[model samples]
Target: MRNTLNQRRSTRQHFRLLEQLLVATILLQLLNKPAVPVLSTLLQILLLAWL
Candidate 1:
């Protein structure tokens, strides 16, 4: 139905936003300090949970 399609589109947009956020976080961390795997890992876990 149209509602289901809308939901799917919204979910996809959320995922895209999250992916951009994750990339930005990683880039910021790398620029601000040495590469920290823990933060990135935690973010990944959080994103997975969100999905």
Candidate 2:
């Protein structure tokens, strides 16, 4: 039925969004790792971007 198909489409969209969030979180953690002292770097980048 149309309802079932719509449900499947919504589920798929949720799954994809979750996957993207997970990947982005992992990437952000990697950037913020202590070895990099990345908070300062990030702040500098943000300042430059804001300007």
| Reference-based lDDT, each prediction | 0.78, 0.63
Q: RMSD for each model, in Å, please?
A: 3.0, 9.8
**Residue 43 of candidate 2: its Cα lDDT?**
49
Model 1 TM-score is 0.65
How well is each residue in 1-51 modelled by candidate 2, as lDDT tens digits? 999999889778766765665566567777776634454465456446544
Error of 1 at 17 (Å): 0.1
Stretches of candidate 2 above 4 Å error?
Answer: 33-51
Position 28, candidate 1: lDDT: 73
Predicted structure 1: clash tally = 0
lDDT of 2 at 41: 63
Which portions of model 1 miss their true places by more than 4 Å? Answer: 33-51
Cα deviation of 45 in candidate 2 (Å)?
A: 29
Residue 22 lDDT, candidate 2, scale 0-100: 55
lDDT at residue 7 of model 2 (Cα atoms): 88
